[model samples]
Target chain A: MNLRRTTTATALLAAALASVAAPGWSDTLRLQGYYDYVDLQLGLQLPTVVVPGEPTPFGLFAENAGPGTADYPVLLLSGGNNMQIEGVSGCTSLELPQRTCALAPLVANWAHVLRFRFHLEPFSRGIVVFGAALTSEAVDTNPGNELQVVSIPIVAEAETRVAFVDVVPETLVDGRLAWTVRVDNDGPSAAISPFVYNASWAYGGLVDVQCTSNGTASCPDQMNYLGPGSGWNIRLVAPPLSVDNPEIQVGYGVQPQEASNAFDNDGVWLVYRDAFFRDGFE
Target chain B: MAAVEGLMRGPRGLASFARAFGAACGGPLPALAAMLILQCHATTAPWSFVVMVVLALPAWWRDDGARLSLVDASALAIALAFAVSGLGPGWRFDGANAVPVAGFVALVLLARHARQGDAARVVALLAVVALLQLVPALVAYTRTGDPSLALRDAAVPWLVVPNDLAWMACAWPWWIALARERAGATRIAIVALLALQLVAFVLFGSRIAIAAAAVGTGYALLRDARGRWIGAGALGLAAAATFALGKGVASLEARMELWRAAWSLFVANPVFGLGAHGFVAGYREWMPAIPVDPRVTPWPHSLPLELLAQWGVVGFVAVALALVASWRSARGRRGRYALAPVAIAFALVACVEASAMRLWVWMFAALLLAWPRLDEGQEGTEAP
Candidate 1:
């Protein structure tokens, strides 16, 4: 047993060592922007939400993680949208010129992490540059800090997010379970082919499936909506003796509508049996 | 029954599947809980983990000596409240709490059969996973010039972030309180782990998490009236700091409006809540603070308020009973007292973050119920 512990410890140490070994890789510095910083628990970042006309000065943060002092910071822009760098230390170009004049190198200094500050920017779609190259004009001995580029992929995320609002299945007095499900768009654009089903009951043929949209059972295609709360409502009567805790799924994948990340494509629920009384095992 | 009937025709029958499924889930739940605590991929990870636990239900039911404990009974009570609430108009019958409740029960049962050294080993194993989480982020940062790589491809394979590291840091009060129990490598590992958590908190900029850690640490360090004072002070400081960290006056205003909405919802349906997942609509429809367009926000952003709004008084009472029972168990028992501070920190985190339905929160909560007061020498692994 001690040997096993030692061996496991040894493996972990090796993995940790391996992870930090490539200290001077070209990607040593992190180039952070506005959209790059948005971290959501159940959501993904897509570039489709940049609104034009507003002077939305996007954020740009150059983080230094290398062993030595790095300098020279530059901001590059491409893509049809005109963007400007505001209140940045090294940006001397004042928003024009692909490469900005280098200010006194930020000591090329950073402590492995930094947070981005939000600002106004004239909305546009294209690329922004970051990294060690932006830090200094001199050749960085550490190639690890190379110039990096990113694009806020132009998307209509407002339309993509669709989710199963609720999937409540109740046990009836007759021992049969009654299920109701609702879908919500919660995004900017309307959903085209919104589909909702009991993912757990994959063997659809075995179960006697009866479902409806807007109380109309057997609508050829499920309901679609252009805004929040506009999607379809489904009522289901599950086959007798279905298993407890079934997983129900909802998503929109018909034409003109795409899922918002994988999240919009799938919302799941765990259906419990009528678990009110004692020994409510279900 | 059908699967059992088919299996009963054979010799081992269902017990065999229970043991097999139990083995598969037992090893990963703690590690996954650790992930759920710290990462944005929390929802996905727990959903996947619960599938494993749910599959093992047959085992939990058939396994002798695994009857419902105080924790289970109270958990069921809370669930029944949600059931009762479902009979109303607003409350939902999603049984969202069942995942965490049942998962906790399964884990406790698994621990009962653990060997003498399993408790220490379990801690060690979970600690290793916590440390290993850095690899993907570090490697991703190196390969791509993005520090938030942990958020993007961070949980690609693991179904999970640095905040997760902070979430794992929530356990430090327990470790720091118990660190002296070991010497040499174990001690060194404990210290290193705590330092890493501190560093992660500083770098992550998750003010709420840092405050939660401070609560846990302060409690562990003081452990008495002074500690309680320090915790209250920390809570006050956290509230101030969190409010300060707000984007501007709008966020504070929004928070006030949000709080008011939560209160109003609770007042309106003080008996039961709008439902388990009713906050999305409640926030949009009733919340006068926001513009228009009422979308989904999942929970009420505060765990206690979420409970009041979702399951209403019954859930609150059940949760309160479970907490008191666990506290009593921790105090009455020897080694378990150390978990109190950590649990308190979890409660504090709920104030800033929504986690009533989070599997990781409940997993640790349940694990604390089953935790041994001391692993050095114990009669058995079961809770007293």
Candidate 2:
């Protein structure tokens, strides 16, 4: 009985010690940071107008005349800022350039289509602009004498930059696990497809990669491209018989081809991995 | 002299066999037989099959002429029906399989023995069982490094969380009764065992269990004082204070959510429920789009609500009726040893932390069989 008791005591002591000395007994601590850029684009659509008769109206008038009518006299004209005119005026009687005109006119009993072009800068991040115009040059303005003004709204958002530092202990085997990390997204524009990859020493074979768009996935098999802010887990299995010190490294960058780095093309980003050991069976 | 001795010994082997057969053939025989059949289908363990066959042999042999009351018969019938249903549904023959069968057997045994005025022995057996449960619980707590959290998790795998608490609550009164009736060494052992169980219960950090212990202890004390009205008033005040102080507000909130889910299930299928273990599937079907994390299990964490959601009004009403009957029988002891535990069990169940079906059946069985026989009662009065 005494021998049995001694053996039991020794076994229990060994078991306890073994638990304290187990590998991968530490908690992985993580510190993450990211930088990103964004670009905005806008387009405009125009409306069309029609006339009832070939009779040339007052103010601005465009007409289609036979080649023989090259010397037609100008009847009315009007001009404005940021406007250009271009079209084939077959009226040789009209004293005008071949395909260019500025606030020109047309002869009576002639019909033609008028085209106008306006150039406005419409892309801004933190600012907005709105404006309008009127068309008094056309007679009876097809439906009615109308004031046509273009109101364009432009907005610009400022870009952002972020950075942080973290410290994680290595005594989690017999203690509570805790860590603190700093995160920043200094923004003129939101980072598109931002992500952070974290790897740890105890389970050094597998890497946990997470993105803003997708959840965690194992790493090193094939890079899972989560479109603009996604992440996935990446698993890495080591050889059956191998021994190495458990360590951690982290690397992160924007997803390729997802976002334009127009705002902060020359920016650097950093991510960190820290861990501690704890002595407990979970 | 040898001839005379032989005559006196007379047919010992045959008598023993006859007695064993009579006990086996009692009303519990069919239920035991059904349990064995179900166990055969449920477990893959060769040893369990052997054990079941061995246990059932006595019941099978004695099943013919053993007398049983109507209540015992009905209880057996209900248990058999449930076992058959569970077998049909393909519930695995494992740890989960043993819960209802063990509960049924315990009830049958308790009721049989209690009605014969063997209450002391029954109570003693229960105390021993409660003490035994403490070993694994302690081991789990120590190994996990978080005693309370470990107890909570262990409760699930063991199916003993709230049930163990109820058993402990019940054991307290039995210990007290034993100590009062049989003093000296027996009383000391009982007291020590009860104290140990109480310590383990407290360390478990089961809010409902702790509350039940407090209530049971207070009721026992009040019973000894013969201050039933004072006890009632104190209990009311305590409940009021708990509610006013918001001590149980979080649990109450969780109860309300479960109640809502139960109500919705009842509204959709007023009969037969969605099916056993069907509350989650049903909830998913009718659950409104709420912006919150999803729950994995269908158990609303409230026993009554879970019952209503899974079994519909019929099963719920039957269970409620059974509880009422058991509570009524226990209350006849007039807030004595049995009454306090019953009250504590009811309180825990009302808190929506534990199911009372198993405990209620067991308590009822004990009440029916263990109450003092009229002759014993008279003898006791004469002795005093």
DockQ of every predicted complex: 0.01, 0.01
lDDT of 2 by residue, B157-264 (tens): 222333335446544545666677788998898888767765665565455544555465557556555546655664565455344444456556555666677678
lDDT of 1 by residue, B1-384 (tens): 444454665666676655555554444334334433333332233334334334433433334552445654554465466566664456443333344444444444444333344455556655665566655555555576544454455542221223334456567665654455578888998888877755555554456567777777676656555456765665566567545555355534555566667777888788777766565446545676443323224445577887787777877887798777666555545442356666677777667553454544555665665564223244322223
Winner by lDDT? 1
Per-residue accuracy of model 1 over A40-99 as CA lDDT, tens digit each: 111111233443223233444555443234444443333332443344443444444343
Which residue window of length 10 is worst by lDDT in model 2 chain A?
A28-37
Tens digits of per-residue lDDT, candidate 2, A1-282, equal 343223223322332232233211110000000000000011123322111111112222333221112122322212233222232342233222222233223322344343333222212122122222211122111101112334332221223322223343323353322222222333322333334323332333443222222243333234432221222332222211122323433322222222323333322233333343444623
Candidate 2's C-alpha runs over 4 A off are A1-282, B1-70, B73-110, B113-117, B147-149, B152-164, B226-248, B284-298, B320-344, B356-384
- Candidate 1: segments with Cα more than 4 A from true spot: A1-282, B1-63, B82-85, B88-98, B108-118, B137-152, B156-166, B224-254, B290-296, B372-384
Worst 10 residues of 1 chain B by lDDT: B156-165
Fraction of native Cα contacts reproduced by each candidate = 0.00, 0.00
Q: Residue B123: error of model 2 in Å?
A: 1.1
